[model samples]
Target: MYLLKRRVLQFFTMILLGMLLLVLLYSIDGLIPFLIVIAIAAPLIVGWQILFDQVQPQAKLAWLLAVLFIPFLGALAWVMFGRTPRRHRRVKRTSSEIRMFRQAIEMERIETANAVSDRFPLTRTLQKLGATGADGHTSTKLLVNGEAKFEAVLRDIEQATHHIHVQYYLFRTDDISSKIRDALIKKSNENVTVRFLYDGLGSQEIGEDFIEPLRESRVHVEAFDPVVHPLLVFNANFRNHQKLIVIDGKIAYTGGLNVGDEYLGKEEKLGFWRDTHLRVEGPLVRELQRLFIENWLYAGIEDDKETWDLFANEEHLPEYFIDEPKDSNGATQLLVTSPGKDVTIRDGLMQLMMEAKESIWITTPYLIPPPELLALLEVAGKSGIDVRIVVPGKGDEWFSFHATEYYFEQLLKRNVRIYKYNRHFIHAKTVLIDGKIALVGTANLDFRSMYLNHEMTIAQFETSSVQELHDAFLKDFDESILIDWSILRKKTNGKRFVEAFCHIFSPLL
Candidate 1:
């Protein structure tokens, strides 16, 4: 009832404003104002229907309602926030820098990569979607949680040879982060080249004072997508959510765990931070290496000649480490998803699910999915495919938690099994299919990740990697609380109201 009343009132206000504006314009001179309105309004009205083809139906309707009700004001809002315009000079400059920076890392592949693609049709589709291909000669380790991941990272940092490249969305100065920083400083003093990258907006808490020691130690520290103008909020929407660590262009690491004490299960508010991390070797580390360089240069850490300092330093450089594949178990591809890309991480996940004949298991910290994804899962469930999803019982963000809960009933009706990890806040983002292949990375199943942010995911076809992920999923499922109909119906009226309100804007959020 409140929703209806709000809409009714907004519509009336729109009408009143339109009438008042028209009268004021006529009192002065109607000709110019009327002609301008006719030209703009006529095209906007017709072209909006065409624009609907580009966006999702719900998002399209939201844009339509704003335009019809608010008229002139709505048009301004649409231009500002409704579209992802890439015409801005800053955007063009950033793109050019990325192209220039990307040239530093190796991208060639061996023969086995092509063979893997031909053998698996889905990998071909994923390649077309993400502009990535499989690297057959590679090794992987499925790290279960943050503690395991950080321990491995610290050990690897201590053993660094030629160079080290590390990036994270969140870079806190907590105990864990401080320890890692000290290790990097130790490496820098050893004359082994080192570069560290962080997202500006996500790691806003890290001050210049925090990073001063690294700079003084001669370590190249930079931030991606830094806020250029205070008035420009749109730039803030696009974030570098990718967490990557590459050692000497051979060893690589990625997953949900960022550098922080909380991630190591040391924060009291969240008892344990359940997550996953992967350590990869072989041709694919170069892919992660390429992404790190792309961001390091784009962040304007430096410009002009000698732009490839991160990749190359002629003076006092150690030989690049040769991290051969521990075993050629199967193929792995490092798939990158970002704004202005060919397709997306979401597309790859959907294609992966289409190949599932036995079961589809998923886990993520957030669950704000678009309608098409919701429909696909419903259909898959009806077809008797084993469909299961694991999410956090308690989320770090309150609004995100309710927005995820909002889709429960719709999914329940279609027989999709939903489980909430009750022991702690689980942040592992993964997709496993048929016990043969898996996806693990930083992209969460939400609008921000799918449509706006820059993210990464590794498609693993290795039997060992897939088996480990499958076993982990089963363990998490065993410890989870299944969300059946009765439990959902027991929600209080106040909680229901809050969730309902949050659901209305979940897509835009």
Candidate 2:
């Protein structure tokens, strides 16, 4: 009854706003010249605001030019949708009970990396970028493909004794995912607390029929930032793209793989899906679980929780919340970037580029990079750093691929070698720097992952982990076809026009 009433209230509220906008426009029907003036002046004003804002000069110019040219997407829609905006902002905040739980379990996000291994001068710049630094003791393993990763993850879920916290951006209702769901349901039947949080937009295909079985088995199933009303879901940019699975607060799994048959290479259209994931043991699960807890809180959004919290407070904080970090099995740290946060993954990646001495190897499915990142890559390449990048040979997204190609000529001029993986889609989001630090997780090197979405990137200073990624990158290099600047620069007029056209909207994407 409460949920229905709240949803009804939300629906009417949106209706009222729509009617108000309609009435406002209706009232101005006779004022055609004035409206036309507003159409022009409004864009100019917003474009100016975008220019003077903290954004980079190149990006500001790009957006400014976009606004000046793109006729339909005027100032109104630009501010409403094009900005690094979020639709999930409202749902994540309403659940005050979860908020209280988060407060109770919150711990100081400390740098747990040991100084003896992670030397001060070497990691100084990284610390300034808000990295928790490296710990040599925390053990990590590199899981190459989806089958191996999910197999290990399912085993862990089955072995979970006390509680399990699982979160993913894409939770499909396919073969691999069904197995996962059944395992979770089985665990829930065993009276183990199983909390599953999935992105509302990413898992939109799974209806109540698919989820009811889990709910019936006492599994705590929730959707993150669900679209309460279609009218409110203007932009699906701020999706929770982080894949986290923590069991009993000790072990966790994260990486590029989502729950789908496609991820397991069963889908013929995408062919062999090549990706990377990590199996984390030791204290790093604490941090990974923290990410899950916070999102879980956000997913459990409720309106009445604000008043309910003051009197019905019963905190079930984890034991690790108050415990101090000591030497763990292996050393690892997380680079978490979410919407509405001061820290960003961009700053950290830039710092790493600035600090690189030898080489920087990158693998991403999407290549639409922000100007700052593009400039940094160029600078890194020109500075005698072996900056090599690998992107998909066939783009899953048309506009994004063209937008990626638009930046290729500049990068090639700087001697930054770019490769296109010819065989299969390389979905690994990883950065190997100087053979010293390796970063792996879900955050892509695109506008959406860099600024708009919730992302998790774990960095390992452990020698073996770094070596594993380096070796994998070298193997991928074997199959990739290198780009020839001479051939690519001579694209036909129509192709060039489309590429440039796509580049205009790349920032918003």
Best by lDDT: 1
TM-score against native, each model? 0.83, 0.83
lDDT of 1 at 321: 28
Q: What does candidate 1 score in Cα RMSD to the true structure?
A: 6.3
Q: Give the clash total for candidate 2.
A: 9
265-305, model 1: which lDDT tens digit per residue? 88887788889999888867766766776676667634533
lDDT of 2 by residue, 205-306 (tens): 778888999989988788887765433554454678899998877788999898899888787867888899998876566667667776775666454232
lDDT of each: 0.75, 0.74
Task: Report how far off residue 132 is in candidate 2 (Å).
Answer: 3.1
What residue runs in model 1 are displaced by over 4 Å at the alpha carbon?
A: 1-54, 63-114, 228-232, 301-306, 309-323
